[model samples]
Target chain A: MILGLTIAIVVVALAAGALNLVLGLLGKAPNDLSLGALALVELALIAQVVTAIVAPLVGNPPSGNPIEFWAYLIAAVVIPVLAVFWALGERNRWGTVVLGIAALAIAVMVWRMQIIWTVQLA
Target chain B: MRVRASGDPLPLHYSVSVPEARSSLATGLGRVLVIVYAILALAATGRSVSQILSRFDEAPVAFTLSALAAVVYIVATIALVAKGPVWNRVAWIAIGFELVGVLVIGAISLLAPQLLGLPDINPFGRYATVWSDFGAGYLCIPLVLPVLGLLWLRSRRDAARQAATVDAEVRA
Candidate 1:
């Protein structure tokens, strides 16, 4: 379940990031596609957070580095919020750039989380 | 003399300014540098702290380097975000060091993998610094950042020069 969600996060993030990369290069106005990509990443992150919370509750907690796990969790939550602020601060290609950065960060964290959980499974 | 916000003198140039106009050559790329730097700051700090707490005995040198990398990343990020002349200087120095550090350390780690080798050597000693294994861990941003940073600095410098020339012509 976690693996599937993690893959979903990466796919959505990469799609958004690639689109943002294109728009950012063209110097186009920030568009909803970028925003939608970011929103999808956020939704996937929220789901990951819920899974992380419930895994421990269910007594099947991840057995990897707890510090790493928590760090990933905190970063996942904070990145999107900070991104929204940064995106809103600029209306040009910069806004899309911000969204791209945030989404990329989310993807990395998701990958890290997967590594942590997989280590536990191993 | 211009006033700077209170912070210890950064050991190097760690701040830079955004160019007056985003060039077609560097628009997405510069933003990529900023994003990568932010992630490095977070990752390096996290690894350093965790290493220190979990196992400080093994690879003291590498872990310390990790911590230092974290500091540099934080400094670079601040320098990148802070605008103006002071920050531009700071960013230049910081990015310069970053490039040097990555190249030097990357070479050492790559040619001398033994330096990072250890199983029970220490808790995290079994692992390596960001420079270890040729930066295989963090996708080699350590190698890439300095190159990008240099480009970013040059772009900003060019913009500054252009602005100054325009100002001079207007005054004349």
Candidate 2:
């Protein structure tokens, strides 16, 4: 994983999470901006996943537990999708809160992925 | 407390008994709880399954405890999402068990890691259970979830009881 790209994703996710939390606190439902930010974060995660998968084929397999790394990768991709689905279904401020939590989790997951990648490289 | 008029025709498929007001487990804040529990359940299941399948022989006791924690999390997640009195009771039991399990496992892992076959010369040494080191791996969410779950369940039960009482008074 490229360090710069990983950091960017984490920053975006955290910002989105904070925004969602504020919206939830203000009794506002998840609006376009919140969803859009999440979409960007999701796209970044997809890019990370692609990079991780392709790097291994290029003889740069993660030095750490590959299975665990892959599990986290897959889970990171799934979290936002599930959160958006639940958020749309809920149609309330709490739905936004759930999205906030999802974004926060994604940020953490990305950080973990970066750690795993660095461990392998080192 | 107005009653239906006698002249008004009932639905053709109306049941003989009145259905109690449905109390859903996934409403408002409960929805957030459900999501949190579901995430934990997924995480625990993934971790335990991977450990057990890859190297069960290395630390059987710790892996088995991890599996047990996964099971408890899964049950609690399901119970928290399903509606009805039966499911409510199941949620209470599952959440209660989760609290007890986390406390016991946390204490054991911290004070007596050797008791659970700790210090194994494996990639993921001893403390493998979800409650190990108070869920240090997952940022202590496992340690805190059950307490929140129990409080949520209690409040919901009280609300349901209050609603039932009001309904009874209206009928009388």
Candidate 3:
């Protein structure tokens, strides 16, 4: 189900975030490992995008207007991508903050997706 | 031509002072602020425009407030990211307005939700601004950003003051 994938993504994102935080605390930004983690999260988000597209196609549409769903979905995909790219340009705690914001956005997107699903179920 | 530390004149490959070369934490953190504000700018604008265009008749008050909030965020982001003393002053003003807007709107939304409610087609039938429900949506960044912005500005000012004191001491 979409819920399962979302939970998995959240777990991956949080674990990666923890690693990034550790690197940040150690005063290491732009580390290979952190960048690797960011890459993984980005890949996972790609999976999310695919899932979002398939969700309504196969089943009842998620709640809200299609325009709204698609709009938020597009934002969901774009925000983290932009954050990661921008963060990669800098090698400091600021970069870590960028990752932090990306993770936070993922969480919000998942929450929104869940709400959309719930509205449909109702 | 530039003289090396050994006092032999060397070819001037590049001319720059140590002060100019040093990168401050503000530059780094300010960049971070820029990214965050940009995200908010996009989110607010998108939501407001969609609401206004898609369902202007549903909740005119809420949609209009959303549009206004988007404008404020956009202005604040631009002012904050612009480089120069003039932009710094503008950033302060924009952020000040943001702080006031959020607080006043948040309080009103909570105490008088009816004042902001807009009729809609679906069951929910109403729209709310970023300040509504204390920014329950978008994780309340609208509520949080102003405070962080003020703190960041104060630290920058403090650093500037310290630098000035050091300069005065050196001159004396």
Candidate 4:
């Protein structure tokens, strides 16, 4: 994974998480803006999936466990979709909070992926 | 096949009555709790699976605890999502077990790390699982989640009871 892309994912995810968390706390319902930010996070995570696959093929296999890296990537991809389905069900402020939590989790996972990709585990 | 209460903003998909939706376990903060449980389940499952598959021999006790915690999280997540009394009881049991498990594991990890043989396989953290040292590895979320789950359960109990009564009547 490229450092730039990793940082970009982290920044966008955190921003999305913060946006949703504040809105949820304010008791705002789920709207396009809040959901769109999550959409963006999901898109970037999909990009990460592509990068993880292509980077490995292009001679950048992960320094850590491949299974671990892919496991985080797969989960990262699923979390947003799951949250979206969940928010669609609840259709309330708390659902927005779920979105926030999922985005935050993605951000954390992306950072871990970066480490797994680059840093050698002892 | 739908009913809507005045203040209850239920999903368009559920076929249940307004009362069920209004007083559901997944209403309000329960939704948030369910998501947290789901995430924790995922994390715990992943951690335990990886630990067990890759190096279970080094820290068998700790890895087994991780796997057990994973099972509890998965069960609690399902219980939170499901409706009715049986699921309610399951949720209480699972979350209650989680609370005890974390405290016990945390205490053991901190006091007697060698009981789980932590020193051998650990590369960085003091212990081998999510419940280690009261979830210190994951910023203590593991320690806190069960408490939150229990509180959420308490808050939802009456609603859950009412919902169960409605279900019973419908069945009868």
Candidate 5:
């Protein structure tokens, strides 16, 4: 996993999540700003996916279990997609909250992927 | 005497709203609940499948429990999404099972770790699956989910009944 990309996804995702949570609390639903923030996190995930494909080809292989790392990466990528669909289907503040939760989940999952990439003792 | 009902109330909207039918489980807060359940379903499925395929020999019990939890989440997610009384009942059953499963598994993992038959290679022996430790691994959301699901389902049921009562009164 690229350190820069990992840090970027984590920070952006967490920030997007906090923003959504604040929006939901303030009774705001999925607007341009909220959706745009989600798209930002989704872009980082896309970058992670691309880097995962290319980095291994360049000899910078992960030290940990590839299966575990990939599992997390895949899940991290899917959550936001699902959240977008759910948010569109229900344009309520809770829908925004769901997006926030998904963003938070992505952040945590990406962090775990990094752990599996660099620090899995097994 | 002629009776004219005010008809169904418009759904409360928070922002640019999507046009949808009124008063179903998969609306508003329930939508959030379903998304959470969907996330858990995906996570549990991925974890259980990977564990079972890779190291089922090392920890059969843990892997099996993981699979069960995955199935439960998947079922509950689908049930919550599908519209109708039947799916609602199915959701109740699935969520109720989830609550019992998490509570029982959490207690067992805490009190009697050996009962799980997990080997040392398994890092989080007792806490292997999502249900373990009442979902502490996932921030206890699993524990809170079913309780909220049941309450939401109950609330929806009451609303449906009240609507029916109003309809009956209008007709009479």
Candidate 6:
């Protein structure tokens, strides 16, 4: 992944996680704003997926274990959609908590992807 | 269904009105738990399959444990979402086994790596299972999840009982 794009994804995911966590702790359900933020994160992940696939042709291929990299990329693309669907059915503080957890997981996965990519290069 | 009070020839006009008993395990907080367990199930299954297929001979013990953890998570996720007494029993069994599995594996991996020949095949240079070192790789959620599951089960049971009592009083 491009370094700048990777950083942007991590920042957005972590910020979404923090915001959702605060809302959950306040006994609030996920509202439009929070869900919209998650949508943006999902869009970024989609972009990352495209970048990951194209980078190889463009001479910036990931040096990591290819299978693992692909697996993480697929998971990153899928988790947010699942979270949003699950959250939509739930209308309580716990619903927001679920989103928070999903956001945090995305952040962690992104960080791991970065490590997997960079370590092989090093 | 018909509800008969003790020593009453006539069935109680009121149904067995246990409102809480009708509540499924996947409501409210339980829904969140289901999502988390489902994610773990996917993660563990993928990791173990990849490990076993690519390098089974390298770390058979660790990879087998990972596979077992994946099964437990899958069962737990299903049971949490399924209805009826059968699913309730399944949830209890799955969650109970998970608690024991994590504790035993965590202890063994941390204190007795040689017992499992972990150092020879583990790429991480330490004994590692899904619960190794208290699930250090996954932020210790494995360590905490079973405990939370059991507690939630207990609370649901309590609520069912309480609702039953209330229904009985209303009938009386």
Q: What Cα-based lDDT does every candidate model obtain?
A: 0.68, 0.78, 0.68, 0.82, 0.81, 0.78
Candidate 4 segments exceeding 4 Å error: B1-23, B120-127, B158-172
Q: Spell out the clash pairs found in candidate 1.
A: B13-B90, B13-B93, B13-B94, B14-B90, B14-B91, B15-B79, B15-B90, B15-B91
State which candidate, 4 or 5, has the greater TM-score: 5
Q: Which scores higher on DockQ, 1 or 3?
A: 3
Tens digit of per-residue lDDT, candidate 2, span B44-145:
777777677766897799889888988998898888777567888899999999999888877878788888887732222333667787777778888899
**Native contacts retained, all candidates in order:** 0.19, 0.23, 0.30, 0.47, 0.65, 0.26
For residues B56-99, could you state the per-residue lDDT of candidate 5 as single tens digits? 78768867998999999999999988855678789999999999
- Which lDDT tens digits does candidate 1 get at residues B1-172? 1244588684343433223422222233454566567777877787778777766786677778888888888888877766556666777888888778877766767666456443322122335666565466666767877787888888767876797678668669
DockQ for each numbered candidate: 0.27, 0.38, 0.37, 0.39, 0.49, 0.28
User: How well docked is model 6, in DockQ terms?
Assistant: 0.28
C-alpha RMSD for every candidate: 6.6, 5.0, 6.2, 5.5, 6.7, 5.9
Per-model chain B TM-scores are: 0.75, 0.83, 0.77, 0.77, 0.82, 0.84
Clashing pairs in 5: none
State the local distance difference test value for candidate 4.
0.82
lDDT of 6 by residue, A1-122 (tens): 67898889999999999999899889998899789878988998988888888988989877765566666677777888988988877688888988888888888888777766656621
Give the range of the ten consecutive residues with the poorest summed lDDT in model 5 chain B: B14-23
What is the Cα-based lDDT of residue A96 in candidate 5? 88
* Model 1: residues with Cα > 4 Å off, grouped in runs: A120-122, B1-32, B114-126
Interface RMSD of 5: 5.9
Which candidate leads in DockQ? 5
Which scores better on lDDT, 2 or 4? 4
Lowest lDDT sum, 10 consecutive residues, model 2 chain B, at B13-22
Q: 3 or 6, which is superior by TM-score?
A: 6
- Cα error, residue A29 of model 2, in Å, equals 0.9
What is the Å distance of residue B110 in model 1 from its true position?
Answer: 2.0
TM-score of model 4 vs. true structure: 0.86
